[model samples]
Target chain A: MLVSLAWRNIWRQPVRSVLSLIGLAFSSLLLVFMLSFQFGVYDTIKIGALGLFDGFGQFQPEGYDDDPDISKQLPGSQALLAADQIKGVSATAPRASSFAILANGDTSFGAAVIGVDPAREPAVSTLYSTISEGRYLEPEDSAAIVMGAGLVRNLGLALGDNVTMLGTGNDGAVAADVLELVGIFSTGVNAVDRQITQMPLARFQETYNMGENVNVIALRGPDFNGVIRAAPDLQGLAEAEGAVYLRWDDLQPEVRQMITLDLSTAMLMYGIMIVVVVFILLNTLYMSVLERTREFGGLMAIGMRPAQIGAMVWLELVFLSLLGAGIGIALGAGITIWVENVGISFPGMEDVLGQWGISGRVYPDLSFFSASIGPGIIVGSIIILGLIPYRRILGLEPVSAMGAA
Target chain B: MKPIVSCRGITKVFGKGELAVHALRGIDLDIMEGDFATLAGPSGSGKTTLLNMVGALDHPTAGEVAIDGQPLSGMSKSALSDLRLNKIGFIFQAYNLVPVLSARENVEFVLRLLRVEPAERRRRADEALAEVGLQGMEGRRPSALSGGQQQRVAIARALVARPRIVLADEPTANLDSTTTKELVDLMYRLNQESGITFLIGTHDPRVMEHSKRHIEMNDGQIESDTRG
Candidate 1:
């Protein structure tokens, strides 16, 4: 009976009920949308970070952090063997790197040219699939090269266009060459895109005048843990070859940093969402209880106990919470589904995200738990705020409440 | 005869120190079961305070009150609420029916609080509304009824519990003279027929004339007690 009475009382002023519900819905919608966008960006970073550059993990020199020179290269043979021994290890590639000036026509720009065995490159890096034009590197072609999209643009070069490379060899001798652009690729990272290229390891060896000298070796496997687990064996191989072992974590600290920072930012935004939602719900429920003081007092005068009155007030708030939560979930899910399918592409925004090494079109990617948590938080906040006025109602002196304005 | 209500040197003070206001000072009263009694006084003459104390809605500051032989001073707030629910009924000057409830639901509210069976609650609510001359009007809300009709609904709510005492604090104050007379006649007949005790506080001469017995208060103290 009291439940019915409380339910009826809420509808007695339709405007108030609706306003409160709207307040809840709006807060919930904002939280859901924001979290979805954050998670979308997070997924982008993860894909870009782990895709072309660092596989899930890497093998590197033991003391590679202090001296990142040719002497710090992890021996390729044992790392490759260890990777093969792991059950789920999918693919591995070894790399050598050097800095040079890429010049085409009158344009010249500094670049870090990475050297790899073309046959093994595709097994480890998504670079094989990222080619926009021409073909990927081929092992027989020592002079062929894949230029970064931004680097190609900066040097004013096209596929099949010949560019001159000028740098010192590993033996401290001048090395120079004309290299043909085999393909143009984008890693999305501005630093990589503006100043990097991929070429055959033999070509790099020929240019550097070092018959077998490689500065670093990058490896890839199905599991990041598999790569990390092979580190000890990789170190022993490097010791045998008088080289040091290094891992991808040492090669790319930014990947680890980016993930950590993004998650922390998401947590900060979540806190802000909670506070904003609580205040809105508190204001709404406070006004509701205030407006109904007289009716509550009357209910008391008619022999309804204080506890019963409190229960009625609580039920009304729960009803409002359920209604708002239902609407928010439906709306949020609808928007997420639509955005995931159709996607939202802002003209210059793609470039902006690309500059941060993220994908162009923003797709709302979310797990069910991540998506549902937003609305659940909003509803939970409303219920908690609804209880704020309960103590006041229970403490209401019936005579004073009756006379209250 | 057993007294349905008894008060001994009851006092009620509001506020503290220099700001203090004593509403009821040393009030002593007792009325037997089945008495139709009215407390007559001017504004702020402590009639409402005395009535509230008897209703168990407010506690006396420095004395004791008993409702149907149960001591109110020693009871907890919840216990007092239960006592009011099972023994006492209240009627107000404003005809305080919850405006959202239909006349029938208003009467049913008290029975619901008493935990009466749903079927019996419905039947008793219907019977009480019919007795109040609102047989077909039970569906109407308080706003749809006249001031007199609203008061009758309040009366029905009070009687549906079959309580030992009905505390009516100026129930006819908001009605016209004709409505007041009609309501008084209705209540008097109910008192005579059912032998339900009533403790009404009012300054109206009509109510005093209509009541079988009257207690007059002056300056926070009872000045006279008379039987018609």
Candidate 2:
């Protein structure tokens, strides 16, 4: 009977009830989209940073990350074979890098010269696909280098131009080579474009006097998120070889920090939005209670306990909030699924995204958590804010409330 | 027989200091079991205030009120509510039927408060509504019923629990003369048939004419008391 009464009472002011429902639904929709967008941007950042050259993560010689000397190389063939055997690892590429100087005629600049297997490197790094000019290195291309666009400009060199490279070799001798520029790649990172170069692995090994050895073994999988979940397995593989495994967080701490900060800010904003929704609900319930003061008083006069009256009011709020939240969840899930399938792109924000290594197109994440979080908060807020009216009902004196005009 | 409702020197002050309005001043009243009494007074004459005191709906400032020998002065709020629910029923001047409920639902409300079994509550609500001449209109909401029908529903609600006493404050004020007479006649018949007591506050002469006893008030004090 109480439930029936409460349900009917809600429709007494149809316009007000509908408006309140719409407000709650709008809040739910906003919450769902905001959380989805935030997580989507985080995924984008992880892919952009980890996909450039390192794949999901990398396994390096214990001390090679701190000092990439020619002698500090791992057994490349053995590590690559072992990494390939690990489950969930889709691909692995071995690379040797050294800080060297490139010179072309009167122009010269310092560069991080990276040695990579031409055919296998493309399978692990997005750098292969981001080449702006010239073709990527082929398997048979010896003494050939792929320079960044900034590096090419700094050294005044063009594609197919011979450039002299000078660095220390594994034998403590001066390693010198004249390599033809086969590719000029631009990854949109100014530092990488201006100071990184890649060459065929055999030629690099011969020039650096490091035979069949490399500084790092990069691994790739279907997705970086799965790779993160497989971190324990990756770590075991690294430990078996006396190597150090570096995930994206370990490789790019700054980007991780930025994501954490951005997430915190987003949550704070969402929290405020939730608070606003709660206040709107409070106002709606307060008005409903006020409007029915005499009715409640009559109920009390007829021997309705304060707690029972409170329960009726609470039940009304639960019904209203859950109805709105349910509708919002359905609407939000539909929009998210559609947006996830087609993707969203910011045409005018490409430059801004590029600065952070992210692409222009973003795919919203459609996970269970994102789908439920918005409606969950609204329901929780309703349960909590329902207490306000319950307390008001408890404090109402039947005689005074009955006399209220 | 002992009086069912007893009030001694009941004084009710609404405000304080110079702003105080003495709504009831030194009122003494007694209502015996099975009595049909009317408290007659104009607005601000304290008839409703006295009725509220006897009904345990308000506290007297300087007096004692006892219903069925239980003094209301020190009783807890819940106890007073229980007393109202189980021993007394109230019918407001405005009819005060919960607008959201159907006629049957309104009649069954007090039974529900008393935690009566569902089947018994339905049976009692149906019987009470029939007694009030609202047969076959039990499912109609208050808005769907006429003023007289709504009042009948209110009467059914008040009588459904078979309370020892029913307190009514100008119950027929909104009804036409014909409906008012019918309502008064129904109350008189219920009093005679069921041996239930009634304390009504009204300025209407028709209500007074039907009552077995009439107590008139002026300026918060009883001015005349007459028995039929």
Candidate 3:
């Protein structure tokens, strides 16, 4: 009976109740969409960065990442092939990288050169498709090199130009080679374009006297999350090969820190939004209770306990919050799913997004967990804050309430 | 017979210090069971204040009120509420029917507070409404009923619980002469038929004429007491 009375009472002033409901719904919608967009942007950044060279994650010699010395090389390509056997491992590429000096007609600059198998490198990295001039290295094309556009510009060289490379080999001998620049690629990433140069693995090994050893084994998976799930198994494989596994977080700590900072700032804003919504609900309910003082007094005069009156007010709030949250969840989820499918783009922000390692377009995350977070916080807040009106009802004196005009 | 309600030197003061207004001054009174009595007085004459004290709705400053041998002064708020629910019913000047409830629901409200089963509460509420000539109008809200009908519903609500005492404060003040007479006649009939005691606070001569006993007040003191 109390429940029935409370349910009917909220409708006594239909406009006021409806307005409060709309406010609650709007808050939930904004919260859900905001969180989904933030997570989507993070996903975009991870994919873009991992797509650069290290695909999803990598396995390298224990200290090779910090000191890319030719001497600290992996045993063989067998470990890289073994890692490819793991579930969800799309592909793997083994590469030997070293810093060397390249000179074209007296213009000499330092460049990071990578030795990769022509056929298998494309399976792990998208660098092959980014070629702007000439062609990628052929399987038997000895002394051939594919360099970034920035590197070519720095050395004042063009396609078909022969560049001289000078470096020390793994056996401590002078390693020298004159290589033809067969390809000029532009990755749009300033760092990669300015320093990276790739060549066929066999020619690089013969020039550097490194035999068949590779320094790093890069692994690619379906997506960022799928790669993270496969990390433990990949780590087990790396341990067997006496190598260390580096997940995206370990490989790109700066990106991880950037995401953490952004999420904290977003959560702070979400907290303020929740507080504002809770206050609005409190004000609406407090006014409603005050207006019905005389009615409450009448109930108390007829032997209704103060506790029962409090319970009635609480039930009314619970019903209103649940109704609003339900509607908001439906609207939020619908919009998120649509955005996820079609994607949303920030026009005129391409340069800024590119600087942050993301494309202008983003897809909102529409998972069940993401959709429920907003409405869940709202419902929990309303039930907890319902105490405001309950305390007010309990404090009312029947005689005073009855006499209130 | 023992008095169903008794008051001893009851004093009630509103506010405190220089702002205090003494609404009741050391009044003593008693009414036996089944008595139909009226406390007749003009406005600000302590009639309503005394009624409030007797109903356990307000606490006396320096006295005590007892109903059916239970002292009300020292009881907890919940205990006092329980006392009112079990032993007393009230009819207000404003009718005080819960506006959202239908006529039958308003009458059954007290039974619900008393934890009475639904079937018995409905049966008693229906019977009480029928007795007050509101049988077919049980489904109508207070807003849909006439002033006279609303007052009748209030009367039925007060009597439905079968309490020992029914406290009425100007229950007929909002009705016309004909409606007032019909309401008075209904209360008189209920008092006679069920042996329920009635303690009414009002200055209306019509209400005084229907009662067997009258106590008139002036300036927060009893000026006269009479019985036919």
Per-model clash counts, in order, read 8, 0, 0
Candidate achieving higher DockQ, 2 or 3? 3
Tell me model 1's lDDT, rounded to 2 decimals: 0.78
Highest lDDT model number: 3
lDDT value, residue A315 of candidate 2 = 88
- Candidate 2, residues A166-214: lDDT per residue as tens digits? 9988788998999999899988888789988999988888998988788
Best-to-worst order by TM-score is 3, 2, 1
Which is the winner by DockQ between candidate 1 and candidate 3? 3
Q: Better model by TM-score, 2 or 3?
A: 3
Give me the candidate number with maximum DockQ.
3
TM-score of chain B of each: 0.97, 0.98, 0.98
Q: Model-by-model lDDT, in order?
A: 0.78, 0.86, 0.87
**Model 1 docking grade:** acceptable
| Clash count in backbone of candidate 1 | 8
TM-score of each: 0.80, 0.90, 0.90
1 versus 3: better lDDT goes to: 3
Candidate number with greatest TM-score: 3
- 1 versus 2: better TM-score goes to: 2
DockQ of each: 0.49, 0.62, 0.69
Candidate 1 per-residue C-alpha lDDT over B101-178 given as tens digits, one digit per residue, 9 for 90 to 100: 899998998888889999999899999988988899989998899999999999999999999999999989999999
Candidate 1's displacement at residue A16, Å, is: 2.0
Extract clashing residue pairs from model 3.
none
